[model samples]
Target: METAARTDEEWQEILRSVRRVHFVGIGGSGMSPLAEILHSRGYRLTGSDVNPSDNVDRMTGLGIPVSMRQAADNVGDAELVVYTSAVNPQNPELEEARRRGIPLIERGKLLGLISRHYSNAVGVAGTHGKTTTTSMISQILLEAGQDPTIFIGGRLPLINANGRAGSSDTFICEACEFQDHYLSMTPAVSVILNVDADHLDYFGTLENVVASFHAFAGLASRAVIVNHDDANARRAAEGIPPERLIWYGTGAGLVWSARGCRLEDGSCGAYDLYHNGEFFTSVKLGVPGAHNISNSMAAAAAAHLCGADARQIADGLRDFRGAGRRFEFLGTFGGVTVADDYAHHPTEITATLAAAKGMG
Candidate 1:
């Protein structure tokens, strides 16, 4: 029989054995947070990015040396190398690391390693709303005095950064599904906001996408929280033991559900939250859009699983103005209110535009 793969604890122990670590393309949203975590752990770190960015400046401020170029020399004297998927396979530093036989791992794998350290790791995964839901969970956890270690894809105003190194055992992160990156994580609670056809370039078919999500759900050690209204999400979570699956949606008979939804100025929403067919709390969200109501429901469920009470969930959702770039409001110019959003996918664009149109 073949030897079993190393457990997360084993991988974490192995990571602890290294001192000097090098990161290629470290300024990326995903890479920077992992770097922050490792640096907090006292690992001497060096990194290189092709372009200057706020993330790069942040790393430099933390006393982590970051090179502006990607030459092989930048990999000097590192015991281990970590690179993002965005980095080219032929990048000089990566080539040098391989040539020198330095142990190498991808950014997602590093995130997985870090997550294993937390007893309550909440991995928020889905085709949409990952960032928003993750931010909401972070807000609730923080408000509840959890002080979770959060790694969101977008900047969270609560922390004034995209990531933070918290002293608590709770770890909250946006678990991206692109290229099956989330498969590497073993979450204590895996929250699936929804499932849809996305990243077709990597996953050739919607079926394959669902399959990948199913695989990710299987990695959850405690529970899988899913969107009950989404058929694809329901399908993705089909085989999970009933006791291990928690469903949240607008519909009735869900473990977590929302009712009496009312929108303020056709944007922000207020709803009565129900848990197990009983009233949990009344949630008034700071963020706009009907979609956000669903996102909040999911966030609420995840937070509850992580020990947040009803009051914390409601207050947290109420305090979240929105993650950076998800329907962000820019200052009005010439009486035309300006706004920015990171909505590329058709589904996301539709929801964003609908929210904007509703504002009028």
Candidate 2:
């Protein structure tokens, strides 16, 4: 029987046993953040990805060896091997690890194990806005002097990278639902921005998706922040206590709500933020988009629950322009506005297009 670490102390023992760690499919968005965090912690890290990306180069520049080709030689005396769900079963590195009886852990389990070290672990979960909302929360914590360790799915401009290793015990990261990855996390504060039908290929049905979100909410130890406008989100958060739940939306009534939109000139979205029927403050987002208003409200609600003042929430969001490749403006060509984005999912694409329409 193979034993796995169940607690932070147990995981620490596992870490001490290994001198170097190898990651398969390391260039991936999900795997790269963990690699960066581990690298910053004085671990000898080696990785291999089937495809090459700018992130691969970034990791190499950080003194972590990365190989574009996957082979058995890449494992190279690694004590522990971590592989993403995307890695092929026939991959030579994986086969070598199995043959050598090296302990192999999946990506989600590694993330959950790592999160246990933080006193305040905020897992931002949603079908659509996990990256955006995670970035917003990171910015808020930064402004409030929390010095949080951030691991976002997309590149955040505020952090100047997709992830950062902070000295503080506050860890903020995106909890993805695909393959029920969020199930591994036990967060101090869990923010459910919204729940929509997605990743059907893995989840099989919409009911399973709702159940997964509910499970994720139940794992929150401190507070559960959700979008009141989304019914799926409300149902999913039913596992948590009523008093522990903090609702944020553009709805008529909620714990945190944004009202009085000022999107006339596409400069910035100005709104009066309300908390429990009382005016909190006037907030102006540096980023443009009506969806961003809701995202900001969610971030502010989580930040406030975590002891951030109104000023920190406002200023943090004000400084957050946007994430890299998230509706990023490229130079125009021949009187045509050119922009680049990583919105591949249909729902994300729809939201991105809607935001683009609101710009003019």
Candidate 3:
């Protein structure tokens, strides 16, 4: 299992040992975020993509070298190489890395270390809403004056920055459940918004997938906030040392839940929060979708558990509109509607389409 925070010694060792590192798929969403974070940390970074992309351009602007094509020579001067799962073992660049005996790290491990550095490392794991939920949480933290170093799977509009290196002890991150990637982080608090079988290519069955969420929930030393409404989420988080379990539902007795939920102007989500059955406060989200109301509850609960005041939570939620590629309106071709989202899996597809249903 992954721990959210790493010791100073561990980080120092990584810094001292890894002088130069290269990324195999630089344009990838996950890879680009980590590359930028490492570049900010002052590691000599070089990466390659199959073609030019906004990610490649952004990396170059950060003083890191990027290439449109992958060459064996790209790994020449680098002492270590990192590659995503998409890169087959037989790939030319990966072959070179092995031949050179350069320490090869999987994409998951690289993201794990970055997650460990944050004082508040949150892994939002579920079959759906990981990206949107992470972005919503990030927006709330941003509004509350948390200079959090946040990394979301998609682009968030509020920050106008994909990843920010903040001075505060708070660090907000999106922990991916694909291939059980969330297993790498040790979060102070872990949020299980909901759970269902996903990434069929990785986990053979839904049972195995639920077990993974259970394992992740157990990693939360402080608390595990779960969607009480989601039987699967509750079941997956069953044995979470009673005290470590915090439940949230739709206006139930859970610690956090949405009350009076509604969409505003068909562009944003609005809802009132009730804490343990009492009218807590109201929030006007800058993003669309009714699902975000529940997503915001989970984030607010996690933030509150991490010591963020209610005002901070409200401010962060208000300021955060949405992330990039998450139902992002490209341009309307007539009234049919054209939007882009970073939902690659069937589960993601279902959730997004469901959100879209309210439109008609």
Q: Could you tell me the lDDT of residue 68 within candidate 1?
A: 93
Runs of candidate 2 exceeding 4 Å displacement: 1-13
| Model 1 backbone overlap count | 0
RMSD versus native structure for model 3: 3.6
Taking the tens digit of each residue's C-alpha lDDT, what string does model 1 give over 222-336? 9999999899999999899998999999898999999998888548989999999999999999988889999999999999988899998999999998888988877789988
What lDDT does each candidate get?
0.89, 0.83, 0.76
Query: Which pairs of residues have clashing backbones in candidate 2?
Result: none
Badly placed stretches (over 4 Å) of model 1 are 1-13
Summing lDDT over every window of 10 consecutive residues in candidate 2, give the lowest-scoring window. 1-10
What local lDDT does model 3 show for residue 321? 59
Overall local distance difference test of candidate 3: 0.76
Question: For candidate 3, which ten residues in a row score worst on lDDT?
Answer: 1-10
lDDT of 3 by residue, 1-360 (tens): 112244535644755688798999987877887887777777898998897877777788888888778888888698767788888777788888778766677778777766767766777776777777777777777666667777777777775556666666666677778877878787878888887777767888888888989999988767888988888898898878887888887846677778777877664678888887777778888667777777888888877765677777888888775678888877777678777887777767776787677655
